[model samples]
Each structure stands twice: as C-alpha cells, then as structure tokens.
Target: MFDPVSTPDVQALVYASFAQLRHCRYLLLRIQDPAAARRWLRQDAVMGLLKARGQLGRETAQDEALAVAFTHTGLLRLGLQEDADFPFPSAFREGMNQPDRARALADANVETWRWGDLPGEQRQDVHLLLAHFRRTPFDEQGPLSAPALQAGGLELVQSVPTCPAFIERNEDTKESRLFEPFGFRDGLTQPVLHSTAERSRRLQQRREIDREMADDSVVADGEFVLGLPNEYGDLSYAPDDARWPSAGASANAPPHFGSHGSYLVVRHIRQHVDRFEAFDAAHPPPREGAPSLTEQMVGRRKDGAPLVQQPMPPADLDGFRFRVNDAEGFQCPLGSHIRRANPRDTLGSDVRSGVANAKLHRLIRRGRVYAGECQQADHGACGHADGRRGCGKGLFFIALNADLDRQFEFVQQRWIAHPQFADLDNESDPLLGGRGEAAFSVQSPTAGTRTTGLPAFTELVGGGYFFLPGLAALRFLAETEPAPGPPAQ
Candidate 1:
C-alpha cells in the first residue's frame, strides 16, 4: 500500500514544524576533489537531519532543520553525466535562464544572475548547497550540522561561505507572528497538498487547520514533488531511466529512480527599505489623510491582516477566500499585490476561469528576510546606514516545484511582471510587479478608487536553479566509480 503518512526520505525536506524554524543558515561549497566528496556524501552524511513531508510525531521533535541541494553544474562535478535512465528536465539541463527571453519573468540579466556579483565568500566556485534552520527566533548559528559537517570531511573542499536568513519577531504585538524588513507578516498563506487519494480523503475528514493537509484546500503534490499525481490526476513528468537504450539500470530494485526528488529555485533578492519608505511618503494617494495608504497598496495590513473583507482580522488570519466579499474589486483593489499575486476568485473575465487559473500556478514558498541594520519599526523616514548600493536587506526567496516553468515561473511572468492584467491598463503588482514604474490602485469606502505612483522596492541580486535529489539518487551518485582510460572513439 502507498503510505502517504510515512515520510519518503530525509532528502525530501518538506517537514512540518510546531515552533516554526525561525533562523536559517546557508553554506555554499565547491568540490575540487571528487573521490573524497563522494565518499563523504555516501558514508558520513546523515540526511535524517531534515524530516520528510508525511513524518509522524517524533520526526520534528528535535528543534533544528537541515537540507542539502545542488545545482545542475554540481552533478557534473561529481562525474554524474547525462544518462538515459535519468534525463534531467530541460529547464535545468539547458543551464541558467536568461531573463530577456520570452518566458523569463525575473528582473535580472545574465550578468546580474551570476554568483560573482555576491560580495565576500558568496562569489566563490559554488557547486553544492547546504541550508539549516532553528526553532527559536532568538537564535545563532550553532554547530555545523549533518550534510555540512559531512562536506567538511571531504579532503578537496575549495570554498565554504555562510549566509544567514531569519525572521524578526513582531515585538510590538503579543502574538508570535514574524515580520520581514518591510513589516509584512509572511508565511501566512501557503498551499496545502497531498500525495495519495487516501491521504486526500483523510485530510478532508480532518478539516482541522492543525493537520498535515486540508480538504479542497489540498493542492496536487505533483505541483511540487516529482513522481506524484498532479492536479490533473496524471503523473508528473520526471527524470527516469526508461526502457530505451539508456546509460544505466532497468530493474527497479534497491535504488529507486526519481521517486521523491524535486527541483529547487533560490534567488537572493534585495529590498530597498529606505527607498520604499521614501516613495510611499512622497505619494500618499490622491486624497489626503487616507487610512492605510501604504497598507492598501500592499493589500494587507503590516500585521498580515487583509484590508478588504475582514478589516478587523481574526487572530488566525488566512482561511477566507476572495470571491465571496470582494469580487467586484470594491474591497481590495485589483492592482494590489495580493490580488495580483493570487487572484483566487478575482481573476480575469469570470470567477470560474479565475479559480482554474489560480490552481495552475501555485507555489511552495520558503522565503526569509535578510536585513542589514533597521530590523524593527521605521523611524518615520528613510533610515539605512550600511548602504550596499542603498539596498540594505531583502528576502532570500526559495521554492520547490516539479515543473519550473508551469508553477514558479508562470506566477512571475503572467501575473507579477505583466503590466496589463484583468483589463487594467499598464498596472503592475504594487509590491513585486514592476521594473521601475509600479502604479497601485486601492479601493476605499470614502475617497473612491485611489491610486499610488511608486518605484521598484525589490531587486534581484543573484540566484541559481538547483535540484534536490532523492536519497537514492544521492547514494547512486556517491557510489559510482569514475570511468577509467581514454576515449572510446
């Protein structure tokens, strides 16, 4: 029987946490010696450090979180070349994505996309990635955990640079909610998905928000993980060793092929806090003394409560949908960030089509902010001291998905970057949807629909596309001995 309750593998790091992993640590490394690195991964690394998605009670008991992921180039470093058994997806195998291309939505050129732009050690020859998380908000980098420690065991390690991402607790509020540099309580809205029919039924029965999955709220697991049935009830296309004359094995025995793997995208995005505050101050809607001028543009209050339907938001504030109260754009403006990002019942033409489109482009976001100095409340004006080109701190955006183009990139291109959406002319997302000129429209009860003229608040620093291979695939790469002698041809 297919047991959806059992966590697949430590490599599939989709674990649930009670206290929420607040502190995140990232390490980038380059492998100069392949033999030693392979040995380290095969023998020393204990991947159980990160619990899987369906893990039961005791899995998340330990407070820390850790996971390992690698770029397409990283696989080549380990001597795992293109094979018939596992033909990697075209998006990754074709290499880094160029932003100017037709399908590209990210606001970065090929030059800005390189790791070289990163200051200090981040620019080193990066081949492998290790990320860690801790439970407490008041936390520091403890010891080198799991796979990272194993990386140290390798003899030919070139460079290791540490990057930190954390969530600052909203000290102003009695609640334990966390806020980013821009003062938005993130991690509130996320997609709930399931791997099996039984699991889906079980989730529907639970109905409780505290469980692993939700009822109709459950998205298809194939949207994120490989080798799972998607929203359309078909198996997602995955890298597999098939029947045709391929490089590797045929029989499915000890080593599973492409069973629990998923592609990961990491973007080191920078937030211009001072510039954002300055712009918002300069453009305070058309009418003076408007309530939540900035908040209306964001579509949500700083505390993460929605400004539309439930103005006085509930304690746990993310269950409600958009169609019921604000279909006519009377509450939340159509150009606001939330409406543009998700759309829900507020999509183009009609409500039925909007619901369908929303399902096609869902993302599993795992992002955290990286601030420089002013970590708390703003002082009514621009206040950034450590100026790295006036972009102090921002979110280290990360997401996991099966189809990069369909799920993650689609949301960026069609919804965010696109200017003309839902019959609106030349209007982009208020927060993330602008190259430079982002105009925001807000629906107010008194002053009618007010618009705010704003500039870009976020910039893409650098990022890479990586694949989180299954533990079985990891073992296969680790154990494969290098081919000897000269070329056959």
Candidate 2:
C-alpha cells in the first residue's frame, strides 16, 4: 500500500489515466468573466472535481475525474499576463495556430480548424480545456452542463465525447480493452512516473508479480514535472529562454509557480479509418515472408505487438529496442511509425548514448480515442474523401511534458515530420506523416527495399498548448487578485 504522506502535490491525471473509468467527455470552454471564473474556481464544486496524486489511490473504483488546463489566452483571462517579469514559453505564447507552428507540424490550413478561432474565423476562442473521465455514461445534466458552466463564468465552445466503438469489454473476464479507430490497441506502452514506479515496485514485491507483465521504464521526475532535476540534471524548461516565476523565493530556493506543474499538448486528429483500411487492402505485403503492408508501416500488429523479428525473451510488448535487436531496419524499418515516435536506442552515435539521449525527449501521453458524428460543418464527415455520411472517428491526443520544445515539438518536427529522418530519403512517419503522397521504404535483408505510397492517414483538426498547474499553483491562480493594469491607451 502507498503511503499518502509523501505524495507530490500534482494532479492525478498527470500520473494516472483513470483507465478504470472508460467514459470521458472533453469540454472546451471560454472564460466569459475573469472575476467570476476565479470565484468559481474557488468554489467547493471545482476544488473537489479532481483528486491530488495522493488522493488518487484512495478513490473508489467508480469515481470520476476532472482535470483542468488553460491555454495562453485562458491564462491571460485568468489574469496571468505574459511579459519579461512573468515569462512563458514562446510555443504557449504564440499557440499552435501560428503559421510557423503549422509548418513545423506539417499541418495544412490550420486557419480552418474547428475548435479555436483564428483571427477572422467565427469559431469560439477556446481558453480552457476540461477533461471529465467517468465510469458512467455521458449525462447532459452533468456538472459540466451549460448552467454549471455559466455559473463558472464560462461558455461551452465544444463538447467531444469518447467513441463507444473504441471500447471493448470481455464478458468472460470482465476486462475492458481500448483501441483507436484504426483497430490497433491503444495506450499499451506508457512511461511510468517516479512515484508510480515506486508504488508498482512495492506492489510487485508483495504479490510477486512478473516484472515482464508490468514492464515500464521510470523517467526522471523533472522530465514531466517542474522544480525537479531532469535527465540532464537541470531544472526543466523548454526552448532555453523560458523562465519559472520565482514567486518571491530566495536565490537558492526553487521556484514555486511552475513546480509540480506540466505543459499539456492537446491535438484533435481525425483518422481516415476507411481510407487507411482500403489502402492496406490495396497494398498487400510485397513478399511471401513479410508482414502486411500496414503492419510494416505502423511497425506493430493490431494487437500492439512490436514488429521485431525476434523479440527478446521474457520481455513485454514494449521490451525490445531498435538498435539492440533491429539496428539495420531489416526487421522493423527505420522509418516506421513506432520507430520514429520513440526510436528506442536507435538515435545518437551508439546504443548506450542513443538510449540516454532518447530519454531527454520522452513524452507521457494520456490520449483517448474519439469517434462519432462530424461536429465541424466545414470538415466533411470525419476523414472520408468520398463524402460519405455519418463517418467520424479520431483520437483526442494529449501529452504531458515539462519542456514543450525538447519533448513534444522535437518528436513532431525532427522525428515524425522530417522527410530525411534516419537517413531515409523522402520518408516520414508512415502513420502520422500528414503528407499526401509520401512514400515508405521497407528494408529487406536480401530481397532489397520495397516502397509504398504513404498517404495522409490522419489530419489535425484542432490543437492548443495548455499549462496544467500544480494543485497549489491552481489555488494560487484562483485566489490571485487582478494585477494592476497599465494606463489605458
């Protein structure tokens, strides 16, 4: 059993997915009145919505969780202004809709996003993101209803619910399984938090459970949380110029403003399920002894197993490393989706250094699969090109990182979208490359390289960068009085 005394003052969602609660509702909101919003944040209703890290293990199996995050505009609305004195990273300051950021992520026509408003668009300006996870079905009269939101000085921008088809329940064992719209098992591999790994280790000692079944690498606490030493033994901050507000601390003391907090990267990606399946059918395996074309592209089977030819014995699904087992890309192609996503000892000069370097760019993902009807009028029926009716499915991808530029952005730009990644020519991440006519090359030991067209299987419909403050910082934000304004222009 975990002792609740030493738990960090971080939100539960940062360390837990709340997988027991299969249902979720993503509420995008706009702050209508800053004063009223702050007042609402201080209310018991809001304070009790989500548990702290310590309170998580004490919760009942049927408990619901609500995690709140604010975008740059949301912070501004909540009275956290950006200036030299109170610094924020440029990525959060400029947001994901900027033209340069759009180019960086290979996102086309970001001005046409369905969620946040562009300069000239009529969509709502999304400021706050509330992720509500529960075991019960979505209720219209839930705490996040229009009336409740209005009481909090907020107005609903949009409500995205979890796709029912993405959840599968086994009647015999009474276990639940989650899969993305593309039929691949989702959330199989995740980085274990320092605190979580400690608890798991204790549990393992008590029950004597096999380590392979629960294999997860523990990352540096500072890699995902502020005010702690990261992999490089430095306080974590993105882009080198970002600063954490001291909050009136001594020179030797750590800053408290961003401590235990994390930056959350949220993206609404629409997956073209039918198109992907059709392309998979059209392009079968090139040779008799190879996996399917889509399997080669994804570097994993639909069951979430890696494509390594001979996986290490007694290792779990995420146990094998590319450099140690498949350095030549003969088994798992160098440019495959999973390879580019993590790389796993395949980067840097050698295996040991590559493993260490890769740890600096890791992300803790807490994404959920989303499917249903098309909400955006402009974006036609999810990802269908033939104008099909009632076809919408995608992923509500979220990642938590202390440094935005080093972790998430680096993975997206340098690894996933880079055409020359791993010395491969004109090849990007086969799954999320977003290129219309991209090609993927499969290296063969003797049969030679086989190439296939890698069309855009997913499209970025909406995205925003948010700061998920620590519980203490959230309270500070709630209680903070408005800063003195400059003289009216």
Best by TM-score: 2
Cα displacement (angstroms), candidate 2, residue 428, comes to: 2.0
lDDT of each prediction vs. the true structure? 0.58, 0.72
How close is each model in CA RMSD to the real structure?
6.6, 5.4
* Model 2 C-alpha lDDT per residue in residues 192-244, reported as the tens digit of each score: 66556554763365333334323325567788887666888786752211223
Task: Provide the lDDT at 325 for model 1.
Answer: 67
TM-score between candidate 1 and the true structure:
0.76
Cα-based lDDT at residue 220, candidate 2? 75
Model 1 off-target regions past 4 Å? Answer: 5-7, 10-12, 17-19, 45-50, 54-56, 99-103, 113-125, 135-176, 195-216, 241-256, 281-291, 310-316, 348-353, 371-392, 443-453, 482-489
